[model samples]
Target: MGALPDGVYHIKLDDQQFLTIGEEGAVTVLPAQDVGQKFEVRRASGDNYAISKPSSIWPSPFVCYDGAPAAPYEGTRVRLRVSDFPPCEWKITAGSRPGTFTIVVAGDGQPLTIGIAPIPIFPPFLQLTSSSGKDLGWTFEEAK
Candidate 1:
């Protein structure tokens, strides 16, 4: 399986909208923009990653404070744990091609497939600034 390195990625949904994390901990598919458009995917343990906004203290994987079913079922809206240490964590299983991945969530060790796709279209957003740190622009590059 291809491992997703930790960083903010620009992911698009099947509906052509982007996955956005609101400052109030609301996750939604909204139009792309700088605000709430970036997501920080951080490594937790092994191949699991914690998805959250750079400024937020909670991670997306925490959406399972109560246990999850042994298998993923559609129409479930799991709630976040409200803590940094995820009550549940996620693993991105590789899909048939690049940029495609399936989400799996686990709580206290038992992992279960969520069977959802958050199609990542590019790598981290690179900020290009002058020596004085003035704002310039952004660029997309290969993950190191």
Candidate 2:
């Protein structure tokens, strides 16, 4: 797998759940939809990309790890942030499965994986976890 072409996309996990923007900008996984679920992926440098919600209100924010790089570990959630700091970028790379990719934090190199929500009622969310698991694969479908 190579770097994804710059464009808008619907990021899916294992072809089942789509990466969605939940209330207050939390990133969660759920069934696919046509609106408010798309991400604008722009190549910042090399394999690094800035993933953001184009449909968001003014001063659009991009997804990034929620903790400091020095302390990153499993369960570090990804959230939409309104900053241009280094942590706001991600290293999108080839994943364990074909036709999929793993999104890694640019600052600490931790791969984003599927994680259970703290509250059972909420859907699964994306979090920084060990790359040793089978949950790091994600598919990028160009949004039409």
Model 2 quality (TM-score): 0.82
Summarize candidate 2's per-residue lDDT along 29-73 as a digit string, tens digits.
888776668988998866678888874465667787676445566
TM-scores for all predictions: 0.56, 0.82
Candidate 1 lDDT tens digits, 1-144: 457777766655442556555444445555567676665567877877775545543333343423343443333443334554645556666543445565556334433443222345232221111122221212212222
Q: What is the lDDT of residue 40 in candidate 2?
A: 89
Local distance difference test, candidate 2: 0.74
Cα-based lDDT for every prediction: 0.47, 0.74
Which pairs of residues have clashing backbones in candidate 1?
none
Give the Å shift of residue 18 in candidate 1: 1.1
